[model samples]
Target: MHMTAQDSRGSRASTIFIVDDDSGTQQLLADTLSYKGYATRCLSSGRLALTAAAEDPPDLILLDVMMPDMDGFEVCRLLKMDQATRFIPVVMVTSFNEKAMRLKGIAAGADDFISKPIDATEILLRTRNLLLVKQYNDFLKEHAGILEQQVRLRTEELEKVIAELRTTHQQLVQQEKMATIGQLTAGIAHEINNPIGFIASNVTSLGKYCERFLTFIKAQQTTLAACLPDPDQAERLQAMGNQLKLERIIDDVPNIIRETMEGVDRLKSIVMDLKCFSRVNDAEQSIADINQCLESTLNIAGNELKYKTIVKREYGELPPFSCHPQQLNQVFMNLLVNAAHAIDTKGEITVRSWSSNGWIHVSISDTGCGISEQHLSRIFEPFFTTKEPGRGTGLGLSISNEIVRNHGGRIEVESLVGQGSTFTVSIPMKSQGHG
Candidate 1:
């Protein structure tokens, strides 16, 4: 028996091993495989083949069915059982026409069966197909690994994007809140100043009245001390009391002064409510009282509501919330003003708030000309307005919507034409920090 091992001629080309007892058969296979651009090796016996293959495996194996010392089936069986050589594809080549012989070869672990005398074309075609299939299988395995890696990387990127979006949203909400408060400051100051002006005037007048009364009383005391020697002292005292009008002035002045002072104090409370609503002194995120914000909004918007609407509040038991209080105050103000504008005649505005499921919900409802179905959907879209020109800037609802979204919340509106409208805002309890 003779043995030969040939390295693949083509760089990066696959190799084929041919084992046969007939020199002619070996020469024929070698020429055929080599002509087809595959590197080929020809061996005269199975023993020499085993030795050569164990030394350096080929990409594929073609074993002859008939051999003297050992048949092709036994060689194939041994090769299949070996862990190092099992991955190599083996095709049995034989002149045997019996079905049992082919089955025996397959049962011995041959990857495929080819009958001889082999057609050169058939040999080439089978080799090409098997090699191509093996290459594709390897590629699929490698590609799957790369695909898994890509999936992991893409998931991480998406998570980063979601986090960034959350952070940007919160910032926008805070900015809108500050803007609304800034706009309302002038109007609120004007409202508070009116009562303060009148109260100050009333206090000044009361001071003068007290001084006049004190002077008149001193006059009466001097006259009485001088005239006590005669009955005319009684006449003089009565005359002085008449001049001072001490009876009625003393009775009514203190009550008037007290009432005026109470009015001034009430005005001060309203101003305090405005301060709370705007949250000018609070931090970005702090414990906020929603009821206080609502009250301030009502006071700041009092002039807008006084003639056209009656305001009512239906407050629920709510816990103190940590939030951007100024922003929430802006939302309240927008809804209230919108409600006030909705009414053509006397109507009602209702503000309600409560907490549930780790969230705070505030609803402002108005009995005014309600929104049309067509308009409701577009209400939150930036620059959309149903108000007459110059009456609406078209940014209020849009800005409010943006603010709510930033706070990890949502705003919804319900309205009916000629009936009224309601705007509800919901915000999460905790800030979902920056992405």
Candidate 2:
């Protein structure tokens, strides 16, 4: 029961457990530690100390070496084995000065050993130093937990930002590509329109000239037959006419001119469709017919669709809606092309449009292989594609979705794995501020 040093240093009142069989020794240690601003609990047996420590672990344990039921070494070993109490420092109190005794205490996981007739200075110093180390360790663990949480949060935020940036980049690239294509097509349409116009006009004139010449030749032959009554002269004129196949020329010339004129008219229609599909005023807003946009897109994408699928139009009466024509054309184009590609061999792509409840709906349905449930949700996600490499960039639907959204519209899709897919685009009739 040695109590000599004054450890009245810290403001914090830390709890310490003092275990000893001797009542005098327990009271002496508790009083000394309590005076030093440590809340002390006195347990008279090793079993009582372990039970108390498990219920409410103290910062440190002062275990006596020589006890009845269990000694300090066994008590220390038990405390160290418990997960909750293992980190608590154990200072063994004994009168033994043998080196083997210290080694046994150390093997039992004791932090330090105090000899009998303990110096108060030594006990206080060792206790204060162990408590400080424990406090520092706890602080570090708390700081590490906070740091890990912060890192997790920051990583999530960065991932979200990176995803957004990738989407934006894909959109920008698509927009630039569409813009260049529009400009090039518009220029080509302008260049070709001039020649087509003149060719069409010239063919029309040529047809009329052929009709006049045929009429004049027939009238001259009839006049010659009536005026020259000699059989030899009339027979010679008939022989010349039969040799030249005059009747065949008169019948075939009109048919040939008509077919040529029809071909020229077809060329003009294609050029007009090209111009409409790639209009130079892409950013301009107008009250446009959605059906007309679909028709123009169909004509422009005919070569892509013709080889694989047949297009069926089921257009209902739709009111003119205010929107960007070129953008809508692009949306229809993407849907049509995708529909064509969905077909493995031959299939039908049905395009339907109708207006109801103040909304204009255009649906492109394919009889081709449909999307799977697993992939349907991610079809509009940027860079998500099921097409083979180099066959697609996977941004078509995503960009089209954005374009439709800007025009106060949405796209809905329905599909079965083996059946087919239908994509419906709905736009408000009174959409505002879309370019």
Instruction: Output the number of the lDDT-best candidate.
Output: 2
What are the lDDT figures for the candidates, one per model? 0.78, 0.85
Q: Give the TM-score of candidate 2.
A: 0.55
Task: Flag clash pairs in model 2.
Answer: none
Task: Name the regions of candidate 1 deviating beyond 4 angstroms.
Answer: 1-283, 433-435
Name the regions of candidate 2 deviating beyond 4 angstroms: 1-12, 19-27, 42-56, 65-86, 117-121, 148-166, 192-277, 280-368, 371-435
Quality of model 2 by C-alpha lDDT: 0.85
Residue 73 of model 1, lDDT score: 94
Q: Give Cα distance to truth, residue 257, candidate 1, Å.
A: 40
lDDT for each residue of candidate 1 in 138-188, tens digit (9 for 90 to 100): 567678999999999999999999999998997687668656754585477
TM-score of each: 0.36, 0.55
* lDDT (10s digit) by residue, model 2, range 90-149: 999988989999999999999988877868888889888888777766667789999999
